[model samples]
Target: TAKASAPEGEDRGLSIVEVAKARMRDSVVENRGQPQTTRVTNDEEEDDAEDEDSGQDHGPLNEAELSRMAAMLSASALVVASAGGRRLRKLHVDLNRILDGKGNSGVFLQYVLSRLHGIERKSNTRLNPEADLSVLEPYEEALNLALIVAEWHDIVPQLQEQQDPYVLVSYLFNLAAEIGHANRVLRVKDMVSNVAEARWFLFWAAKRVLEQGLELLGLQSVEHM
Candidate 1:
């Protein structure tokens, strides 16, 4: 009986050991079958960080270029104004003497004053009220006298053909000043040169004054002036 009982106890001890081992194996297998929690690499994380930093580092040169461009434009404007003013002054003197004078003074003076007023109104531009009217002051009497002396029956037609009465008056005045006579015939070249010069000067002066005035008014210089 003792031997049989001892064998039974040994069998029971073996069965308990086997059951414990089987439980441990099942627990380990179940844990392994579920997904693994992957460990992230430090090199990949560092590379991602570096990429983010690089995205924020776009170059550094916007403000300097803008300042340079503004300065260049201002310098260009000054040069144009200085050169233009001098040219205009020369033309004004030449044209004024040619167009304003004694003999045809009344008619031409009326014409000049009327034109001046019209131009002033249209452009809203005012001549200096106190500016010296020396060149034009005697135009009325001078033009009338010129008309009397210029007894040519076709005077009106000839003068009108010149388009701008101011130009014709200038031409007549210059002729009178230089020649001391009005009705004298002129060579074609002399006539052409005189008219051409007067027109050039007049246009140049007008452009200069307009630009200067705009500058004074705190406006940008017009591109086409």
Candidate 2:
């Protein structure tokens, strides 16, 4: 298959989809029953972090790095159907942007799952559905955040009927943004009994929604970054 897709004289070795599938296999072992510090392990990770801390050069990723970028892109296309979209008349693949965690990229999507995994580890317990949702203050930011998680089911049949995974992709990115903002106000650990329990449950639900969404997209849905 890689041979069929490769341009003339370019021995790319592996297709993007193959590479992503390989990583999905790797993720099962990598995320087995634990929370972790999931940072990207590629060549650029160290430089990217250092560049963020100091104002240093963020050089371009080489062809080898671009293949890694393709893995994320291919997998994400199966979900959202569009980074630029799965079907395009003409598209330019930007290796830098796809690998960027802050942007609306697959890495950012994984980061959300990683944070939810951290919350679960911190709570050190499973979801208690009986947790008092009514206790959530009307003005609490998490109130809105939970509402988004609640929409997960509503969006599913649409994706199936329309045959477009991008809808779920949109939902997930939005969900991640809301949860990231709300976590500042909704402390999961070291809080009152009911509050901690309720927030933990909320996050647990969010984490599942994220994981399921990614799984539907045929991605690994990492426990860490």
User: lDDT for every model?
Assistant: 0.30, 0.59
lDDT of 2 by residue, 1-225 (tens): 011223223325766456444544344333332223343345456434322211122233343443344455446633343432433334444433443445676767776776676666554555778998776775467788888988887899887787755577778889888878777667776677887888878777887888898887778754433
Q: Residue 156: error of model 1 in Å? A: 37
Displacement of residue 50 (Cα, Å) in model 2 is: 20
Model 1 agreement with the true structure over 162-219: per-residue lDDT tens digits: 4433433433333333222211221111234343233223322333433333343243
Per-candidate TM-score against the hidden true structure: 0.17, 0.64
Q: What are the runs in model 2 whose C-alpha is more than 4 Å off?
A: 1-90
lDDT of 1: 0.30
Query: Which candidate comes out best when scored by TM-score?
Result: 2
List candidate 1 stretches off by more than 4 Å: 1-191
lDDT of model 1 at residue 15?
Answer: 42
